[model samples]
Target: MRQPREKIFITCAVTGNLTKPEQTPYLPITPQQIADASLEAADAGAAIVHIHVRDPHTGNPSMELDYYRDAVEQIRGKNRDLILNLTTGPGGRFVPSHDNPRIAGPGTTLIAPERRVEHIAALKPDICTLDLNTMNSGGEVVINTPQNIRRMAKIIRESGVKPEIELFDSGDIALMHALLDDGTLQGPVLCSLVTGVRYGFQPSPETVIYARNLLPPNTEFTAIGVGRASFTMVAHSYLAGGHVRVGLEDAVYLSRGQLAKSNAAMVEKAKRIVEDLGGQIATPLETRDIIGLPQPAR
Candidate 1:
């Protein structure tokens, strides 16, 4: 039986690669905006911030080293204790051409695995996401073969950053166990069970318990609800012995027909939900201790 988490930590995913600029006027775009949004979320009781940079002018996802550096530096300057979890999920989406499916399509961003983690090596944040799902994502397919995953894992490990395995389905959890057995990923790992994405894990209580049961012993997991199910999973995740995550990356609306003004607003709501369930929100310093992350030297 999965026990409830008395003390939980909320991770605010400030910006994501898939969320479009036109989705909401308040989504953070530039490095400064991203940093400011992260700080605001932390102030709203989010212990960690999951970040993905965007091109300031184009508002598209960017893997540029400078963009990451600028966003990371700005956040570190203001808040030293807020855990930073950067994304290496870009450079893996494959949009196959209609004429020749093997040929890359316009939206395909596939690249050498090392190139994907270049930013991770350059800027070693406290944590970075290592996606393991190779499922269909809308019109495109995400390709994360075991070989490529190992290559990227090597770089993330070498950088001294923890990889929060993003598991979209039960098979991904199996892959996680394989990596642990081979020593590619260490044990007592940290991961996120992302739910509510179409063609991925469905958002439901049964789905949460099934996936949570598959994880290895003592593994720290967060049950993330994307889209409309975002806040609902905050309570679900907490009751299932896991953490919770929410932000513009997951959902834009605070309620039906009402758009969230900022990432801070979403965090504030998630904080309220967890507390109403008799759960305590962990601070960044406390989160580090709970997750076994050491504070970085100043």
Candidate 2:
């Protein structure tokens, strides 16, 4: 098994799908805002930038292929070296009707695995996320059935974009192993252990360490502690031989009761924390090599 490296990598999840301008004014809505934020985060020492676009008019999460194309092209036009990770987490939201069990009610966003990954095939970001379980999240069911996961994994593999397997709880380790064993996903897996969502794993450093310990040998992991737990989990993940992620996607605050003004602010804070711990921030080139992605042609 390959060992964890000394250099710490920071992924800035710039402008997630859910937050709105009211919730945090820093939330980037239009393609230009998203692109500019990504570049700014990269400049602030983020090795990877994870993106999810929103409708410019409504500020709602959007899966429109053109939105992704515009944002991706704009980011790439300026920065060739950063690792880009677009999210596939949008179409999996399912809020079943309390009145009728059979009825897939309002807020149901489930789509075919092929449709969920269409942007990836077209734009081909260096990485994308694959949520690993069907679970209760934010009072809704995030339905990523094993069959759906395998189908998505297959598509991601075919597209040559690495999948960041997102794990929210410990039970998912078995499913992760199954995916690995069955070749649904390839070796040296990239995982993001997410905690502190409404009903997933609790946001605790112990939970972070436990989840990190469960991955297969040589697996690369990003520890995400949603909301208030974000910074603590990032610190725990780094200390436990894993990577760290921070941004408005997981957190809105730069500190207690302080809303972060920009994605760059979050990245800068993560950079300080990582460096203060005596680890150097990994460069974009180092990040791709660490995850086995080929460097772009010079």
Candidate 3:
């Protein structure tokens, strides 16, 4: 008899930080909306929900502890078993003044390294993103120096929360390894290959394969293709023995002109695709076990 195929972890990025509702009407902003979207995704076979809280009033990205707390509480109240992966990738954007570069502009929000992961450390989510490299992120500069990453990694490790190292480009794989070598990150490091962003790695099968090859042995990883590359990359990642992430945080449309009503819809589509390809979807408990997340409290 043939052996059964391994079940793949399905992570849903419920709401991205920067993308506004103007881009897509389906984006979830308020705490209740986030919680509702996450619950739906969990029902649709997503083992984990990768979250980013937005300003309740303005719909802008926010790192406020209150927002994170409210969102986490709401989701946990409903789905106790769903894994929540909070984001620490905020507080690092730098957009200099065009005329006078000396003074920082309004777009700059660079905070101290310790402040970056403050929410995650306090909330104690199952996982939090640890963006390892500094890069020109689209029109803005996402400054993540080696020193800051070390400091942030130390905090994340000490907090007992797994860090989902985000690699926007191939070079970040090397930086991730360095974090592991310096004892800042522990074993079974989880990675996310982000593609189709303005200045990050472009979405392509070859690029995904190349990036995956560079990861350390025994690493668990996933792939996210932003915007138009979403579905294609999901299919590619599944084929390459990696996990998948989908939802409004990555792509808002079901097709070129169609809008996704919720994160659950996106997960449903991914589930269909994965099943058609002979793969099984992972449950929240299985995902927690795979990623070494702390079990839900009784």
Candidate 4:
């Protein structure tokens, strides 16, 4: 008997937590810009829009509730069907002062676990990220203790939002298991393997396979590779029966040296790759079903 092929869930991370306008001119900042990019990505075959808000004035990463509210409202106004997945991954960066190790620098943004997930609980997004491990994010430390994750997960679950467990390294899988055991996270689980971040898992075929093995039984997962490995990792993930995520948030380049003009451009390229590899892209409704999100009331 032949089995039907699995559909691919295409998630577009419209903007990230780290990249600034100085790094790439195309990064979306204002609520309008983020909404426009998200709509464009949805139109180009993205099933889910993974979002992170930036300061409207400075274009820096922001955990402000108003920023998230504005971005979500604007995006829903334009495209009611696009699934919104807000990031609760911010407010956990710890950067020590160069001059004195004990002195925290301005870069540190650590907050209470409940406080970090407050926006998601208030806004009630369909999905939100719960980064599962503490790692050296670039030069700064990204601290996600087991207690923090459990606390945040409980809040997310109570809000009726699915938690997209984000694993930066293989060891984080064990942390996820703990969440499942403690009843903080529910199944069937959805995980995203993040690669190419400094001091995290490197993007490679072997790494993807190893990470997949560590996931809970019958869990749905995706892989995203930052910088130059974006496209390559997408191809690898697709071939391995996992989904793929891409956008300016992960990589600004369409190729080795060419910069992507918009989030839609990245989605278009990802669609071509998925089609060429004999996979079908999941529609917005299918993605909602897979991730346990209700249809938009709008």
Candidate 5:
């Protein structure tokens, strides 16, 4: 078994593609709101902020490059050292039509693989998520085939930005090994084991152990629990020799029946949980070192 780290890093997913504005009043929508929320999370001890842009008026997910540029610039202007992890996960969902199973429905956002990582190549954030799952998601199906993964991976590699592989199931981890073996993905790898989704990896101690065992050598992973399992998995992940993540993206509640007022609120609670367990929260600078990223110039 891998030993638990002396210092753990916390990632705050400020906003996500699936979270609608109607769900929570505090969900960051516009670029300015995203930037502000991310800065707050950083202040509250989040070493990295995972971001997804949205339409300013409707609060729907958007793949516009300008939206990304504005939010990234705002965050970088204030905190040069904070790590920004942009999402390349939006354009992969497909909703089938009732009339024809083969035809894409209204909610389908499937686009060219090159378009998904367009922001990554333009902005060149510290890290970007590369999802490797082709799974059922509610009524829609998220398709990320090996061919598309390789195409997107090529762009991420060319941009000089690290890809934080998002694994939803054990099979995804298996695919990760294949990617590594084929030299499509370079290591030492940084990945997140996402649990608690209904059709994805189940949230439990056994799940964490099983998944961690499947990871390759020199891998750094964060065990992220969605919905109600968010805080519970913090303890589970830390004890299982992994990092932790929490925010509005993963959950909206601070506790049972209580809506979190901001992303920073979630990060503060996650930091407290790790600290109470005698695990230190790594700073952005320290995280850069731990994750093998180059130090920021003074």
Candidate 6:
């Protein structure tokens, strides 16, 4: 592990697309609940809130523009300075039909690339995620071909929203380089090293360092681990000269045999990890500067 950076920023992923409420009752489903979770995370020292909307009725992920709008508006209602990172990663699931290999199966969620990033244009958050790789996510394939990637990057760029590239494994670094060469992705953007998903790289300090070494010089990385690896990787991330992310989206458990009560718990737990390591936790405004963004508009 390398020397820890001066300022460690925490991004709390309040809710993710895959997690269901039945699995964890605290998972925020409604717009109000999502905003409340973001606030709780912010209060717990998360400089940014990585957000994904869900269907309030079913507690499943949804790309409804109104849901995004409501969640963004409510978060900004009190704290405009807290950076909002909306997810553009939905609408890419592809499950091939068994009967016919060419046709999509019932679980397929492929949509026009334009539809995927439509909310970034509407809400204009400080940052939005652009998944760089097309990989097997769970049993289904998450499709983000080169063409679709370039298109989404174009839309996200035009809106002045910073694109945080998510990498599940080492090969995604190649895709990131390709996007950089084609001018689809801009410099100094964020990269999230997402480890510990099914078939993805297992979460560990060595894995974090491997991915960190592959990132471009201009890219800043946030190391996120799923499930049990979540908190452990926080220490690894900091020691490896990277940032950290936590919340119910990455892991529902606060510790062994214990489920996290809220997003705030994850944030607070990770904050302790950062501070205990002789590092300073960046405030939201400080985090904006760390990531090369202007202060919130008065």
The pairs that clash in candidate 4 are none
User: What TM-score, to 2 decimals, does candidate 4 have?
Assistant: 0.95
lDDT of each: 0.94, 0.88, 0.87, 0.87, 0.95, 0.90
Worst 10-residue lDDT window, candidate 4: 1-10
Between the candidate structures 1 and 6, which one is better when assessed by lDDT? 1
lDDT, model 2, position 192: 91
* lDDT value, residue 234 of candidate 5: 97
- Across residues 95-209, which tens digit of lDDT does each residue of candidate 5 receive? 9999998999999999999999999999999999999999999978999999999999999999999999999999999999999999999999999999998799999999999
- What's the lDDT of the predicted structure labeled candidate 4? 0.87
Clashing pairs in 2: none
| Per-residue accuracy of model 3 over 102-181 as CA lDDT, tens digit each | 76788898999999988978989888998976888867889898899989888887888888999999778887777778
- In candidate 5, position 73 carries an lDDT of 99
TM-score, candidate 3, is 0.96
Best prediction by lDDT: 5
Per-residue lDDT of model 1, residues 1-298, tens digit only: 9788879999999999988989999999999999999999999999999999999999999998899999999999989999999999999999989999989989999999999999899988999999999999998899999999999999999999999999999999999999999999997799999999999999999999999999999988999999999999998999999999999999999999999999999999999998998999999999999888997678
TM-score of predicted model 1? 0.99
TM-score of each: 0.99, 0.97, 0.96, 0.95, 0.99, 0.98
* Tens-digit per-residue lDDT, 205-278, candidate 2: 67866787788988889888888888888777788788999999888999999999999999999988878887
Candidate 4 steric clashes: 0
Model 6, residue 190: C-alpha shift (Å): 1.0
Q: Indicate the worst ten consecutive residues by lDDT in candidate 2.
A: 1-10
